[model samples]
Target: MTLLATHLVSRLRLKHLRLVDSLARSGNLHRVAVEMHMTQPAATKMLQDAEQLLGAQLFERRPRAMVLTEIGTFVADYAARLLRETDSFAEGLDNLKAGGFGALAIGAIMATTPGLLPRAIAELKQRRPLMTIRLIAATSDILLEALSRNEIALALGRLTEPKDALAFDIEPLATEELWIFTAADHPLASRESVSMAELARLPWVLQPHTSPMRRLIELTLARQGLGSLDNRVETTSIFATLHLVREAGMIACLPKSILVEGVARGTFARLPVALPNQLGPLGIITRKGETPSANAADFIDVLRSMTAPGEELG
Candidate 1:
């Protein structure tokens, strides 16, 4: 083996990795030392040792802040990733010793949380009772960001754009149907069928312009020679939309799954108009090249089984 490789494998310490990782965040040796519960001189010694061992300068000492050299940036990034995996491994071992399966963290879009995620979680727990599972409910855009940051192992949502296909291993699970709705007692709610132009005249409660739902609404309207809605309130919250529809007399377009319960309870009524543009297919997304952990793979199996023939997602 090369001398540097030999030195790294034999002499590198966890404290050294932690120092670099902390330095990357704080950019100040004294602050990193305080965070690591060591003296500043000790921190400096660790940094020097790391630089000498790697045969590359890590941080450039500046008056106000230490800046990472190119090699330092790469090493710091790797150290951070390595630290995360180490923590995960320790946690997995602890769980196994406690007679539990390893933990899993997954994110899902708002529409999927109402039914899909809960059902899948229930099924997974039945198979692995002590497995730890965490779910983050948010918009697809937020979920994708979390996925990219390694904050989530899996995501159940739509790809925000075509380029997302290249960044993630996306498995198309199901298609969501978009429907328009209003409060049960609204004037338009009683109509057997409503025209798009007539509905366009009324105020609406809609997701923000960046959301996939809102883009679909714009596309559908544009296809019909109608412009974007001018008389609309924008929000990303489903609860807010429901409130505006019920108390403020504003119309909303949402997934059928999200509205089914409300419609059944006589709280909201589905509009008769059909939209020309449909939201893209919902899918399972993972980092493109990495494999899912055993527990994550099992949970995915549950999701797939639930969506199998004759039992499609609603």
Candidate 2:
């Protein structure tokens, strides 16, 4: 290694980064000092030293609160990420000392959260009771980003086909079907089957504009000659979508599996409309070279075993 690279860490301490993170949060020296357990002058000098060490002024000091300069924001973000990693490392050490298995971070999409993941998690818990688990439910786009950042060890979500699959070890777990749903007491709920044209006339609750599901909704509506949905609520959160559809009499499109829990509780109803049934394969996505620890490997096995027989793991 170069001499500068070798000595760089020796010149910097974790406390400096902590001060930067704290300053970024409060933006006021007095409050930052209290949070860091240092005097105000000490906090101020630490900020100055950090800026000097980084070879740039990090914050623009105002009369009351300091505003982060462009570089300051970047540094703060890096510091925060590093701190999180540090804590995770510490947790792993603690777990090892306690005769416990290490942690596993998983990123799951909507389809798996309500159906596949819960059972697998329960089984993994029974097998590896002391393993720490962190579950983040989001879209494929977000999950892929997390996987790339090592924020998640593996992802259970949509898998890209041959083109993008080259960068990841993609496994086909299941095919998800979509459904149109609304509150149980909705005007159209008791009908035999409503036409898409008729349903499009009602207010809707839809996914965010960027989600693949939303694009499908738009495509389906466009084929029926409807310009756009009269949707006033757009969210990615399933809980919020359920509440809006259940209480406000709005309609939405979601994976069929996500409704099982709600439908069982009588909070939502599936509309008897023939919506699109095709979705690209949803599966386990891991980095091309990613290797799972023992805990994650066991969880992966449980996930595979939980897949329905017809939708076999591949």
Candidate 3:
């Protein structure tokens, strides 16, 4: 058992796991080496070492493909899980040394920041004042990619469709209804609600065309047979949109969260238009089968509590 343990320790080095994960992703040893910034020979040797320790052939070296053998696939899966857990453990230990309860790295889309995330952060800080929190504001696509790369502990944003590809455990936090918003003094704001036809006639402030929100908005408008409006202002800035809507009287559709406080303060008004809930469900997404940092998990729990039914949003 002692010899076996030593052999296993030598095989499960960080370099070995990195090689295994890369090969599993690319299915090519040369590509894995290139991605890891190592020579192909070194990568080949690492794989050989790992396979020898496990006493199993991990790959079938076909001319056109480096396919995983049954055992190889299993080992790769387990290796990925092991690496994730090891990272979480290391982070937890670092937090202990720093005299903090734990560290949380979180990503949030712009729309979520105004209400959803602030509430979570405030609650977390109040409870775990010593904990370290890192917040990143980005678009959904950027946040998702960062989450996949393990740069952030978790992401808070609209749930992605075709959920299978997300490969995460998602806990729904809130479902913010979409609404058309404009400055309180805007002509359309005077109306209790505006028609979709009327909405399409105004100059619009919108997210960039590449965004999922923009695509969904366009599709919804097209389905209604409404010709596109003058998209004179294209931006990813939620604050800019809010300001534009409040001061410039430009029309923009946004999740209720973004304008909640502004609407309450009479800076903006929600149009009484029957807009479809273009806003998707908001949720916390974490890599599946991986344990999060204690602080991250605790922060998520706090967010869940704050957004629970009957809880008031500040």
Per-candidate TM-score against the hidden true structure? 0.75, 0.82, 0.65
Where does candidate 2 have its weakest 10-residue lDDT segment?
305-314
Which residue pairs show backbone clashes in model 1? Answer: none
lDDT, candidate 3, at 172: 71
Best by TM-score: 2
Candidate lDDT (C-alpha), each: 0.86, 0.81, 0.77
Residue pair clashes in candidate 2: none
Question: What's the residue-level lDDT of 86 in candidate 2?
Answer: 84
Summarize candidate 3's per-residue lDDT along 1-314 as a digit string, tens digits: 69988878765788787788778878888888889898999999999988887899998888876888999899887777677767766876797688877667789987677777887898888888877777888777677776876768899875455673457777777666676788988887778656878778778898877566777778888989887767559888877887788777789987676777888898888888755645556678888888976678788888877777533223
Ranking by TM-score: 2, 1, 3
Model 3 off-target regions past 4 Å? 1-95, 163-166, 210-212, 309-314
Alpha carbon RMSD to native, model 2: 3.6
Tens-digit per-residue lDDT, 104-139, candidate 2: 889998887765788899999999888899999987
Given candidate 1, what's the lDDT at residue 301?
91
**Number of backbone collisions per candidate, in order?**
0, 0, 1
Residue-level lDDT tens digits of model 1 in 1-314: 99868879899888889999989888899999999898999999999999998889999999999999999999998788778778777887898899999888899987787788899999999999988777888778888887886778999988888898788988888887888999999999989988887877889998878678888888878787888799999887888989999999999998888998889999999999888767777888998999999988998898888784333355
lDDT of 2 at 157: 81
Superposed model 2: Cα runs more than 4 Å off: 62-65, 145-149, 159-169, 192-197, 222-225, 228-230, 261-267, 274-277, 308-314
